[model samples]
Target: MKKSQALYRSVLIIILCGVGFMYSQSESVYQQVEEAVANSISKGVQVGQEALPIQLETLKGEQVSLDDYLGQPVVVNFFATWCHPCQEEMPIIVEMEKRLKEKGAAFVAVNMTSQESSKDEIAPFLQHYRATFDPLLDKDGEIMKKYQIIGIPTTLVIDENGIIVQRINGGLTFELMEDLVIFRE
Candidate 1:
């Protein structure tokens, strides 16, 4: 009877240890993923009442700045070819662009530097997706670093005066995007 009790105690201790180890491992993984996503979504115009400065390259290799669009509302979306959420959201963004353009709004996209892709690779992705907007190449990730991008799909809405009014993190549908782009309080 004492031998059986000892054996049962041993099993219980082993099971408890296993449970503890599993919980710790799961927590570690969760934190890693959370940090990664936080890093990607890290780049934004600014946090409340402050606007981020603008200076970035265009797809055609032209230098552009927010000052250039002073009199027009501008939408800047940071996207990557390999990100699944970005791919799913692109069509909706395209439609949003179309509707905004019809309302005289301007929009552009910045393609984050991708080790998994080249400009050649990206061109086809854009073409196949029917994304009509010019996608700037952040090949060196300098802009990404500047923006502090921790994530794939992020957006900034700059008003006519060139002040960034809203920065949306993550993928958004057309209607929600429209609300951000066209409406300004």
Candidate 2:
């Protein structure tokens, strides 16, 4: 009877230790996952920072640089032709540009052509949306990487002094676009 009791206690201790080990490992794994998510979420440039340099060719084949518009507010939108949200947001962006350009604000839509199949589609796409403002092509995706663009339809609002005032990750409604560029509060 004494031997049996001792053996039972030993087995119970082993089981408990095994459970504790598993719990510790699971906790470590959870922490690692949490850290990774936080890093990814914080990857993009923040507001109040200076806008990164961008020099690219417009669909019209003209070279444009962000520095050229530093004395006035500039709207830099990163997009791809194939992105549906980008297509949907173009009209709103066009209106926003019209309203803001009167106030001396510049708008540039940087096309992510590196991910696009053919550059031939860009002109037709712009014509379809009646996008009258500058449409720059990021042929090598360098500008997109410089901006840390994680998704399509990302817009950055840079103030006259070249400071980034706002960063938007998704499509913008007309109201939202107006609020961002006009009000900016």
Candidate 3:
């Protein structure tokens, strides 16, 4: 009887130790997952996050940087000429250009040149749309990837301090654009 009791106690102690080790391992995994989520939230495209720095040449060949517009509100759009939604968004953007500028905000369009069949399509598209903003050429798609842009017509409405105030994933109306960038207090 005493032997059986000692053996049972030994088994119980082993089981308890195993459970404790498993709990510790699970706690470590949970902390790792928590840290990864926090990092992603800080780095990814989100409203109130600082806009990533962009340096690229315009279709006109002039160089520009997002930093140049640091002290002014800016609208940063990622678009391709082939995208119908981007094409549709052009008119509203064109209409708002002058008005946004008057409100002390600069409009910046980043052309996803890498997605185009030919670089020549850009000039005509801009001309056809009567777009007033000079488009920054993202020739290698690096900027798009950096911004983690999963969709066309992604617009980042950045405030004067360079914090993204809004992230519009698809085409936005003129009134909505005004409400986002112009009419904001």
Candidate 4:
């Protein structure tokens, strides 16, 4: 009985050590991922750089491309339905859309659906927010990777000349949107 108890204790200690090692490794990995995301966002496309070409399908099944809006300023927003910050910024974007469209500016919301299971929540979410701009779906995350989108609610303001003017990494306020739309360099 004494020998058996010693063996069991040894096994238990080994198992606990293994668990602790795995936990620490997982925490380290998580921190690395966060750092990678931050680095990507910080090093993403800068102002004065030509906007990257984007070819994606809208929710209405229409294909849209960045080239299609070359003659006008464009607001390209990356978001997910499950993101609260993304949701919070939707109304402000919608207002921006309405106000900016009247001035020949295009606002395009791109949904990050690649990591999500289904996009069924999109319609209801848009309806709830009264969003009129047809959102493009980044189903395979190609657009996200192309844009180096490390986080949701990242927005890019592109000028009529196809140069990126501003990049926002968080929820946008109405005043900021207004300023971005009105003050173009």
Candidate with maximal TM-score: 3
Q: Give the candidate order by descending TM-score.
A: 3, 2, 4, 1
lDDT (Cα atoms) of all candidates against the true structure: 0.76, 0.84, 0.86, 0.85
Question: Quick one: best lDDT, which candidate?
Answer: 3
- Regions of candidate 2 where Cα sits further than 4 Å from its true position: 1-44
RMSD to the true structure for each prediction, in A, is 16.0, 12.9, 10.1, 18.1
Q: Which stretches of candidate 4 lie over 4 Å from their true place?
A: 1-44, 181-185
Higher-scoring candidate on TM-score, 3 or 4:
3
Please give the clash total of every predicted structure, in order.
Answer: 5, 0, 0, 0
Which is better, 1 or 3, measured by TM-score?
A: 3
Clashing pairs in 1: 39-150, 40-150, 40-151, 41-150, 41-151
- Give the Å shift of residue 115 in candidate 2: 1.0
State the lDDT at 29 in candidate 2.
96
TM-score of model 2 (CA atoms): 0.73
Model 1: residues with Cα > 4 Å off, grouped in runs: 1-44, 47-50, 114-116, 181-185
Q: For candidate 1, lDDT tens digit of each residue in 8-84?
A: 99999999999999998998999999897655543245743324555666676797765666788878888988889
